[model samples]
Target: VDGNNVIRKIPCMQLLPIILFLIACLYQGERLDHRSCEALEVILKSLHFDFINLQATQLEENGASSLLDMILYYESTTHLDISDNSGMGTSGWRALAHLIKQSVCLSRLDVYNIPMVGYPALSLSKALLTSRLTVLHLHNAQLSGMPIYTLVAALKVNKALRELHLTNNQLNSYQDALQLGDLLQYNSTLKTLELSNNALADAGNMFVFTKLPLNICQSH
Candidate 1:
């Protein structure tokens, strides 16, 4: 079938249309790009709310494009699970940044195993600047070096995030933990922090707890 006909069959599942379009294009051996994603964006306004779970499949750039469009254009979706999918790339991360820039309605973001580096890291950092995410999980996704620093900087200004899981992401140095500790000193909204199996020194771990806010509920 042609692209127009495939687009016509797209349902109200938000990003699902983009995935279908992508499949049709691939079956016909055509390249996919942002233009199709833009077309799918036109139908997003009709969706009231969404709780999509694309964790089972290997989400590729097309899926990321669609997801990013949903994040950028729609405000009704509250829960999105993109865990265990290693198909997203730099472009996808960049798209996610746009969503973060435009929306503050996302409460939970699970981006586990989607490795990000370079500009994409910068974009996610930018999202943290204004994102209303209450539970943010970036487990073992190579978020070291500058990305960690950027996240720490955003935490200083972010007031809505409650749970931050940086489990097993190679956060080994004491200074890194100290930097996070410094942010927690000023951030009272965050309650639980999971930093297990990292390279945290005993003293650094001690400092993190000492610097934690008085109202913290848990930190594992």
Candidate 2:
């Protein structure tokens, strides 16, 4: 049960040993449930693809870690989805951020239905600072308030970012969207933005994000 030793031994290992263990002291062989996922991990690792959609909400948290490691570390995936999980709380988001910090192949991410509560902003801001992410999806995720400064900083260097989706989240106000407009005014990387079903109704138009190249001061 030495966690450190296990981690140290594996230490970002790629190929998982496809083992058919006996839990009830009965050898099940390929009848084991995890074998399918392990086989998938091996296949993905061998192909060297850059994306995987982990939309299966039922994957256990521990198993998710292994699958994430396989895709991120071995396959160098730049895009991932861990959407619609029952137990995927803030801790999962933090773990994804940890992986993002270490991930060089990852550039875009979609975390569905998770609560942000400032962590997404913080994590993504950090990720954008160190990584080459170009797209992000936080649909239906719980996020309160507009992270103006973080978004500002993120937009400055996030050259790869071309689209942003914040649908069905709590953004508090339009200031950040407007600030995002200002950012788009100077930073031409982003072209499409979706803030639908958010708290963006305040002293502005949706056209602002679309008309970023023109005068932000133009009457709406």
Pick the TM-score winner: 1
- Model 2: per-residue lDDT, tens digit, 67-104? 55566567446677666653544555555667776776
- Estimate, for each residue in 1-220, the C-alpha lDDT of model 1 and write its tens digit: 4555555666647557666564455324233344544554544554544564445355467667675777556774676666676656766777677776667676787777766567766788888888878888888777766778877888888888899888878776566877778778878888888887677878778888788777776555
Over 4 Å off in model 1, which ranges?
1-46
Ten-residue stretch with the least lDDT total in model 2: 19-28
Error of 1 at 188 (Å): 2.5
Measured over all alpha carbons after superposition, the RMSD of each candidate to the real structure, in angstroms, is 5.5, 8.6
Candidate 1 pairs with clashing backbones? 172-199
Q: Whole-model lDDT, candidate 2?
A: 0.58
lDDT score, candidate 2, position 210: 72
- State how far residue 7 of model 2 sits from its true place (Å): 25
